[model samples]
Target: MVTASSLGLTERQAVILTVGFYMITALIMVSCNKWALNTIELPWLLLWCQMMIAVILLKVTHSTGMLKMPEIRIDVSKALAPLIAINVLGLGVNTLCLVYVDTSFYQIARGLVLPFTVIFAYALLGQPSSSLVLASCFTVFCGFYTGISTEVNVSQRGVFFGIFSSITTSLHAIVIKKSLPAVNNSSLDLVYYNNVLSMLVTTPIVFLSGETSKVMATLETEGFQAFHSFLAAAFVTGIFGFLVNLAGFMQISKTSPTTHMISGAVRGVLQTLLGYFAFGDIITTGRLSGIVLILSGGAIYTYAKDKEMQTTTKPTYIPMTQQDVDGNEDNERKA
Candidate 1:
């Protein structure tokens, strides 16, 4: 029933292609990040590499005139500082969580982001949702709790970092929305600024955290082969990371955030399945049920939000009888 024009695609074939690109890139980004973390054991350094690559790719794209880069004035940079800080912190903690947690559990842990986003939206932005939306969010929370409850060999530290990551991620989203108007509502501009600022902020932390020493030691003991392997993994992860960001921007711009969220829910399922097949993660009945609940609740929340937007934006029409038209004509003549 949906056409390319209806979804703002370029051509008839592009609708599926765009959605697939977005979803696939997102899934690959998570899988590759987890793989890199498990293999290299340098989460911060790996993240730093990814950010550096993103910046380089952005610069190249700008140079080629594929994308326009926004100038960062002092005023705009100052306004965006909080968002940049929170974004960096959220990502740093998320990587740490991945390092400490199993990939399957990591997916479940990150599921907290949506509920936290809703809470922050209401608390900070004063954006209220209908009862159905609220109830759906509650269902999502229950699903996450169910997953956590049934998790075997759970890492407490990982869970702790995951919780903070969710909090920071939620705040990052809210701040992004608040700061977009300052950045001319360009998500790509925000991405550029965020990556640049994140690099500046993360460089010192990467060294201070002693990941640099660990990497150096590994290079010494394992030789250039190990270092080369790490570099290759980091490079691939970086490319995937850039694609993920680009695809995310495209997805959100072409569709609503609700649609983006629904895609994310689907991505989570795929990532969980990949974790099981690739990493031998244990999958239980309870965890499976939790995944179902989370996906269902997300879908419901998205539908509710979409319906609400439609209702709010729909135009109202008034019907007039011939007598009313005649009366208005007589009044116009008198005037």
Candidate 2:
């Protein structure tokens, strides 16, 4: 869609096109088959698919550049190995968790990843928490409570799966954040490598878990509907998923963890709306209440962070040499 058309673009217009890409992909996927679509695994799978495609497209676009390619100092193997391990473990658990939890409930519960990231930061990075951060954390807890209250069937396993997903996601985030310094990786490269590694790891599981057989069954029984979902899923990962990661990585780190946490609340709202409008899924009273708390907290978090950023000085990226594209490394500073 718009994203595909805007490939290689890095402008405000490109960003808008990217949003259009996601909306179209979402609409198409949800409209094709809600039951099958909802049952599909985490969008991470699609993320990897997009990485593989992007790599191919990049190669095609830069065939001449490939011949004269700069010898990037990165150890692709080393960087990818740990990322793949964490991502596969996280995504595997997430995929299984999806089977046991409804999408809306899962969305609400996943907001807890924000708190988990703070905990992970404290534990892994020795990051100290201030009173303001502590207060924000408390707010997040309250928000989570309000959000999950409306979810149906409060089973123990459901709770376990949600918690597990949060922990893995938090760990994955920390791992990526820590790796950020040494590699000074682009979000595209980070995603591409992780996806490549995860796909390598997950391909075997796809066979072992009988996912392959299930996919075949889906094709045999559901025909074009199944095909459409498959294509939609692939497109989502290839295009929209990449943009989402890029935007979040670029934006979220600039804000406080609490602000990021509050914004995390919006996934449930967006997903619930998509479910209802696109698939005729019921918008329950509880979900409506949860959306309100989520939005309120997010608004508070954004307002606070905007005020905070206004008081700080951070350099905005100015395109320089090829080495300075990201402006995140010694090379960029040297240049």
Who wins the TM-score comparison?
A: 1
Residue-wise C-alpha lDDT for candidate 1, range 1-335, written one tens digit per residue: 23355666544245347567899998888888887876778888888999999999999999998888887678888888998888788888988998888777776777776787678767875778789888888888888888878877778888889888878866754566566666766768878887888888899999999988887787789876776666888999899988887676555434434445567778888988998999898888777877878877887787776566456643221112122122222111210
Which runs in model 2 stand beyond 4 Å of their true positions?
1-55, 64-74, 93-103, 154-159, 216-232, 245-263, 295-335
Model 1: residues with Cα > 4 Å off, grouped in runs: 1-20, 306-335
lDDT for each residue of candidate 2 in 50-72, tens digit (9 for 90 to 100): 55664555445457654222233
After best superposition, candidate 1 residue 277: deviation in angstroms? 2.2
Write down the RMSD of all candidates, one decimal each: 9.3, 6.8
Q: Report the backbone clash tally of model 1.
A: 0
Which prediction has the highest lDDT against the true structure? 1
Model 2 has a clash total of 2
Instruction: Looking at model 1, report the run of 10 residues with the lowest lDDT sum.
Output: 315-324
Candidate 1 achieves a global lDDT of: 0.74
